[model samples]
Structures are given as C-alpha cells and as structure tokens.
Target: MSDLRTRPTTKRPPTGDLAAEGRRRRASIAAFYTVLIVVAIIYIYPFVIQAGTSFKTDGDSTYNPLNPFPSLFTLDAYATLADVDFPLWFRNSVIVTAFVTVGRVLLCSAAGYALSRLHFVGRKFLLAAILAVMAVPGVVLLIPKFLILNQLGMYNTFSAMIIPLLWDATGIFIMKQYFDTIPPAVEEAARIDGAGVVRRFWSIMLPMAGPALVTLTVFAFQGSWNEFTHFIVARSSAETNTLTTGVAALTTGQFGSGNRYPLKLAAALIMTIPVALVYFVFQRKLVRGQGGGAVKG
Candidate 1:
C-alpha cells in the first residue's frame, strides 16, 4: 500500500490510425499548395505577357503574343507615347483621383459618423436610404447621372466628374459599420471630459480609426483612379480626358496613327502601376478590413 503510489502502468505503442491520419493531413496540404500554385500562375501569366509585349515590336507582339521574351526589345512604343497626350492624361488622372479620393474619404467618414453615433429624428430612415442607394446598380445610373449632370450644367467640366461621386453609399456603409464596432467606453470618456461631438470625433474617434480610414483611403483612391464610366458620360472633350478614357480611345483606333498594340500595352502598363502599388502597399489592411467588415455585417 505504501509503494502503490510509485507503481507505473505499461505505456501503449503508437496506433496505425494516428499514422494514417498524419499521412492524410500531409497529402491534403500538398494538394492545396499544388492547386494554389496553378491558380497563381494562371492569374500572373497574362501580366507577364503584357509587360513583355510592351517592350516588343508590333510585328513581334503579333507573331509571339504568348511569348514572355521578345526577339528584339524596343523602347519605341514608350518613346512614342511620351510624345503624345500621355502626360496630359496622367495629369488629369492624378488631379481627378486626388480630388475624388479626398472628397469621398472626408464626406463618407463624416456621414457615417453622424449616422452611427448621432441621434437625429430621421437617422433610421436615412440609414435605410443609404443602404438602398448602395443596392442600386451603378451601370444603370449612367443615363440618369448624365441627365442630372447635364441639367445642372456640370457637363464637360471637372465638377461633372467629381461632384456626382463626391460621396458613395457603399463607402458610407463601410465607415458606419466600422464606427459602430468602436468601444463606447472610449467615447464616453471623451464626452465625460466635456468634449463636444466634433472634438470627440476629431481628437478621439478618428485617431483610433486608423485602420478603417486607411482601408477607406485605399478603396477611394483605387475607385477614383480607375473610374471609367462616369468620365465617359460626364465629359466629351479631349482636354478633359482621363487615363481610362484616353487609353480606351487609343485601343479603338482613335489615336496613335495605327493599330499600335505595343503603344497601347505600354500605356496600360503605366496606368496599372498606381493601382498595383496601392494594392501591394495596403494588402494587409485590405484583408483585415474585409474580414472585420464582414464580421460586423
């Protein structure tokens, strides 16, 4: 009885089932990476071809559309595009994107904060209206937006491009959801210190909302920078053309003197640079925002 505490039992050997389970898990992981690698190659190969083709001659592009290496690399396409409206198009895109991104971020955040935190008479109804607007298809609004812009006499102007898109329903929704997730205790502390609504939002809330704000900035910048349809309906003059419209014109035999594939590809590659940069820079935030917002929704 005294030595019973020191007694030991026989240990069991490893089971076949455990070994089988480990093998199955390893196989599943290997299959997942195999599929992932294939998918990544499929998505990335087109860009590789386009980038390579941009450096090739027109004859080389036609002959070797699938080739990622050119028989003879030429800078003529880029050199030629540099001599045309590329600079103007780039400038216009920068101006429009800057204005629209700034406007959308500020306006959407303001609207969202008010909608989420403020207690107004029609807050519920207004929130519902914003949700409804978000559901409306953007492509269907092409004509209506054009008519309203035309009637307001904003057509063919920068105002035409910027005004209608100054605020978006979807952006407002994202901001509202993010704001709602913020802990009320922090806000309460601010209010207890006798800070007003504006001060609380500016000094307390916004600073704490760095992640959401960065996410919104990325979306606004990308959306406005790549905007195509709104520009088409809002302005018609070459002087007002954005990169999207100008490059589109290039593709449809509207400029460049011939079916200039290399020139157009070069232009596309250039236009893609900003978006690619933004995507890579904020990819982590983008994934986080997506997951957080999905949870809230």
Candidate 2:
C-alpha cells in the first residue's frame, strides 16, 4: 500500500520524449528571439545611420551612404545650423508644442467626460460626428483649414498654428474610452456627497486618469512638434519656422545645396530628441493606458 501510494498513478513520459520536447521548446524560443532581434535592427538602422551621418563631413556622408561609422567626423553641420535661425525655430516649436499639449489635454478631458457621463440631446450624434471626422484624411482638410484661418485673419500668426491643433478627435476618443472604463460607482459616491458635475470630474475622476493623461500628453506633444504641413499653410515667414520647416529648408538648400547631408541630418537628429525623451519617460504609462486601467487597485 505504501509503495503504491509513493508510485506514479500512470507511467510518465519517457526520458527521451521529455528531452526532445524540451529541445523543441528551446528551439522555438530561440527562433522567436532571432526574428525579434532582426526586426528591431531593421527598424533602428535608419536612426543609427542618421546619427552617424550627422557627425560626418558632407563629402564623407555622400561617399559612405551605407556606412554608419564616419570616415571623417566633423561638427561643421552643427556650426552651420547655429548660424541659421535654428535656435529661433527650436523656441517656436517648444512654445507651440507646450501650449497645444496643455490645451488638448484640458479640452479633450472635458469633452470626453461630458460625452461619457453626461446625458444630453445629440450626445451620440456628436460622438458619431467625431468618429467620422477621424476617418477623414487630414490632407483633404488642408485647403479648408487654410481658408478658415485666412477668413479668421489668424493667417501667418502663432494663433493659426496653435489653435487649430488644440483639440483633436483622437485625443477626445482616447479619453472617452478611458472614462467609460471607470466604474460608475465611484462617481455615484461622489455625487451622493453633494459634489457638482465639474467637481466630481476634476477632483475625483481626473485624478484617477494619470496614465491616460500621460499618454494623451505624449501624443499631443509629438504631433504638434512634428507638425509641418499645417504650419506651412498657416505661416509664411522664416521667423515662424519650426524645426520641421527649418530642417526641410536646410534639406532643400535654402542656404546652399550640393548635398548638405550632414546639416540636414543634424537638424533632423536634434528635432527627434524631445519626442524620443517624452516617449521613453512615459512609455510605461502609455502601455498601462492601453491595457485599460489607469487606476489599478
């Protein structure tokens, strides 16, 4: 009885089979990692080459198109950028991105809360309209946007550049989705305590949306910072040029052309830094927001 109790109820898999299965699992994992590494390299190689080319001389970059390591490193490109209005462009981008981000976060959160919680006539219709707007191609609206800005007499001003982007369909959609996931019980308790609608949203609910807020902020900053086409249509002066337009002008030989690859690459590299930093800092929060729980118990 004791021996039977100590023994296996059924025969276990043979040692050879277990070994073979283990080997197969290891091989599968190895293959997965190999593919992942290859894909990462493919995605990252362009940025690596861009950084390398920025440090190379113009002749070196033109000659060594495939090589990431500079044959003759130089800082002439950076110096050239300094002589231009690069600092001014950087300042303009910073100012525009900051204001746009703040406005989008505040306005989108308010709109999202109203759409998700408040009952009003045409609420569903308004959401449907927002969805429809999201589906429309942004390029199709460029002419209309330009016309509106011109009619408003906001053309060639920072207002034209920043105001149109202050509230976006995507931000509202994201916030609404997040708000919907919040349990109604929490808001009900706040209401029972005599909290007003705005008080409940601001002091109770918005505080719980930290991850979603961070995600929205990241997207807003990136979009506004990289905005080029709208800026082009909105403003026509060199003073209003952001990094995107300024760098583009450098690439197109506004200064002078003969393959000034280094200058262009340097400008591109500088412009990418802020977005990259923001992404890295809030990447974990963004992931949490996507997983649908900003306020985890």
Candidate 3:
C-alpha cells in the first residue's frame, strides 16, 4: 500500500520562484504607498491652508498665503461673520439641504428599484429620457430653470429651491446602475414567498443596498450642501440667501474693506465643515465605490 501523505512523483510544487515573487510584491506595495502619500499631500494642502488662513487677519492671509500656521490667531473673521446675516443664511442652507437630500435618496431609490426590477411599459423610454437629461450641461440650463420656476410661481420660495432638485437624474442613474449589479435571486426568493414589491425592496433589496445607500446619502448631502449655482438663479431676495449666495454677495461688492480675505476664508472654512464630516464618516465606502468597479456618469 502507498503512504497516504506521500505526493505523486510527477506532482512537484514550485518553491524557488515563490521567494522572488514575494520580494517583487513587497517592492510594488512600497512604490504604491509612496505615490499615494504624495498624491494625498497634494489634495490635502489647500484645505490646510484655507483652515489656517481663516484664523489669520486679512493682512496675514494675503502676505502668508502659503503658510499652514497663523502668525497671530484671531477670531475677528468669525466675529465679522456673526455681525452679518450669516445665521439666517446658515439656517436656510440647512433647511434646503436636508429636504433635498432626503427627497433625492427616497425618490431616486424608489425609481431605480422600479426601473431595475419591474417590467413595465415605457421603462426603456423612461431610462433613455433620464440618460438624455443627464447629458444636458448644467450651465446651459440656468436661464431655462429660472424661466420654469417663474412659470410655476415658485420663484424666491423654498419650494422653488427644493422642488427642482428633489429627484436628481444623476442620483437615479447611480442607483439604477447599482441595482442592476445585484443578483435577482434574492428578489425572486422573496416573490416565491409571496412578498409584494414593497416588501421585497424594503426587507431584502434595500438591506443589501447598504453600501450604495450610504454612498448616495453622502453624495446628496455634499451636492445640496455646497450648491451655489441653482441657489443664485432661483432666488434673489435677501431673505432667501443661502451661505453660498450670501458669501458671494459679501465678497464681491465690498471693495472698501481691502479684500476681507480672513472673513472670506472663514466663511469658506465653516461651509466646508459639513462636507468634511460627511467625507470622513463615509471615506471607506467612497473608496470602495470608486475602486470596486462602480461606474459614474
């Protein structure tokens, strides 16, 4: 009888190249990290400068634009922000962003799920229309959007601010693409169990879509939070000013103040905080979305 543990004479493992392969892999990893660190610094340096400059005086910011540390830290910039209509602008921005993000997430996910799973009439046409709308350049829509808003009698109102952006084409597209990648077995099983459309999506599909939902949440939050273009064209009233519109008004027309760099920088820094928080919280998911073969239009 042959020994059970003995290998066949013709079957030999290759061992010599394993050590060389290990060394090659280690070298590649080191090079990759070196490049990553350099790229990270390039991306992060501007925010560092912006944060430091916000704490400096106007004169200090202009003189030491590249400095990552303030010569003499001061709260004068913040104080000036408090003196204006900043609080109101901040509140309006918060309200609009919250409504828009929630609306987009719910609407886009529903539409995406229906489009991906349901075999209804006009589905192909609806998808084609969405893709076509997504291709339309945003800059060219400025006047058209304003005209429609005026016609709808939503001009200068919160409805005007929120309605146009409630269900974004990009969000719908992202969700549809994500839903398409999911295997249909789960939903089929739910259907076999006599679960309805809502039940299947709510209990099975949406739970499995955790990563995509988190990604969508982050996108919606960032897009609505930092939105400036639509806000500018949608409303002209001082009462309707968001942080972006308000800051722009402050920065451009006040030439008598010798630039007001510190104040401007402070406003920018403050506005950036929400986006930074969202990014830090969901950075891992974002990396996965970009790296794990997720497609974006």
Candidate 4:
C-alpha cells in the first residue's frame, strides 16, 4: 500500500509556464468583459437618448439627436402630455392589462394541465391545432380576427381589446411544457387521497407553478400593454385607445409635425415603466426560466 501511494498518482503538472498561462487568463477575462460592456451600452444608450430628448425642447432635440443629456432638463414634455389623451390612453391600458393577465393566468394553466395530464377525446387534435396556430404568423390572423370581432359585435369596445387576448397559443405551450415536467406521482397521490381533477389541479399543481406563472404574467402583461395592430382593427373610438394606439397617433402627426421628439419620446418612456418594473421584480424567475416545478426528469 505504501509503495502504491509513493508511486506518482497525480498527473504531471501541465507543461505550460504559470506566468504565460496567467497572462492568457487575464487577457481572456478582459476581452469577455469588454464585449459585455459594449453590448450593455448598445442597449442602454438608446434609452438614455430617449430620456434626454424627453426633457428637451423640440429645437434642442433636433439639434442634438444623439445626445443623452439635455441642454437644460425640463418637465415641459411631461406637462404637454397632460394636455393630450395620454391619461385616458394610460387608463385604458391598465384596465386591459389587468383583465388579460388574470384571464391568462387561469385559462392558460388550466389548458396546459388538461393537455399535459388529462386523458380525453380529441386531446391530440386540440394540441395539434394549438401548435399549428403557433406556427402561423400573427399578422395573418388580423383580418380574420377583425371579421370575427365585428361579427360578434365586440368591435369598438373594451371586450374587443381584452377578450381575444385572454389566452394565447404561446402561453398554453409554455404552460403545457412546464406541466409535462411535473411528476405524475404527485398528482396520483392527490388522487388516492380523494382529490378530484379540479381539486388536484387547483390545490396541488397550481401552487407549484410559480416560475411559469410569473413568466406567463410578464408576457401577457407586456403583450397586451404594447399591442398595436390588433387594437387598431378592434376599436375605432378615442375612448378605447390604449397607449400603443394612442402613441402611434402621436407619431403620425396627430399631435402636429416637426418631430415633436420630446412629446413622443416622453410618451414612449412613460409607457415602458410598468413592463420594466415587472421584469425587475420577476427577473430571477425569468432566469430560472421554467414554470415547471423542477427540472428532474
């Protein structure tokens, strides 16, 4: 045993000199951080410019397009927003976003659970249909959606804006993928304890879907909040205008010409606040990036 231990068990040290290897390590780290910083600045600089322009006068904004600092910071642009339909648009967005988020939370999870767990007729067909719908581009459905909304007499109303978006194929897909990862034994245990389908799903499964639920909530809120083309065909009245449609109107000279950079940018800047907050709060879940309770197969 002593002779075996004395015999060299460890491999010889790598042939490269320590100093040279250390230099290479330092250089690689420097290169990686350099790339990271550049990418971060590329994303962050546009927002800086937007914020700067939002505080500037029209002339100053035009003259200093790339500058992210105003000559003299002012709230004039925000004040001008008060004079327009910005508040009304903001209110409509809040209402639509709240309703859509809640609806998607319940419906998407339920559908996902059903698709992933329940054994029922037409289940395969239904899942196939959802996948096919996801494969199609969203723009292709605009006219069909418009026609359906108009036919159902939901056009030009809040229902037009909210109902069609309450559940989506993508949300269903995410939830299903998550639910599939959950152990069948868990649900079976609940069943043996006299839990019904609804009981098991509601009391056992739903609570465990935290990551996925957070993910879906963020997507649904952001999608409905920023939805533009659908809202365009869904409603025509100013009363029904959400931030996306209302802000688009501002961009198209509805609020007058000559860039109006401050007003336009301020509106865009304010509208992004809620989405950013949601992202910040749930970013960890976003990173774990799965809604299924755990990753174990």
Give all candidate RMSDs, comma-separated.
4.5, 3.4, 5.9, 3.5
TM agreement with the true structure for every prediction: 0.88, 0.92, 0.85, 0.92
Candidate 2 TM-score, C-alpha based:
0.92
lDDT of 1 by residue, 1-297 (tens): 365566688976579878998899999999999999999999999999889989999898888889989899899989978877889999999999999999998899889899989998999999999999888889999999999999999999999998888899988998899889888888888788788888877777676666778888888999999999999999999999999998888777556565577888899899999989988988987677533221110
Score each candidate by Cα lDDT: 0.86, 0.89, 0.86, 0.89
| Model 1: pairs clashing at backbone N, Cα or C within 3 Å | none
Residue by residue across 78-178, what tens digits does model 3's lDDT show? 99889888899999999999999899998999999998999999999999999999999888999999999999899999999998888888888888888
Model 4 regions more than 4 Å off: 1-6, 9-16, 289-297
Segments of candidate 1 deviating more than 4 angstroms: 1-26, 254-259, 288-297
State in Å the error of residue 208, model 2: 1.9
In candidate 3, stretches whose alpha carbon ends up further than 4 angstroms from where it belongs are 1-32, 255-257, 289-297
C-alpha lDDT of candidate 1 relative to the true structure: 0.86
Tens digit of lDDT per residue, candidate 4, span 82-127? Answer: 8888899999999999999999889999999999999999999999
Which is superior by TM-score, 2 or 3? 2
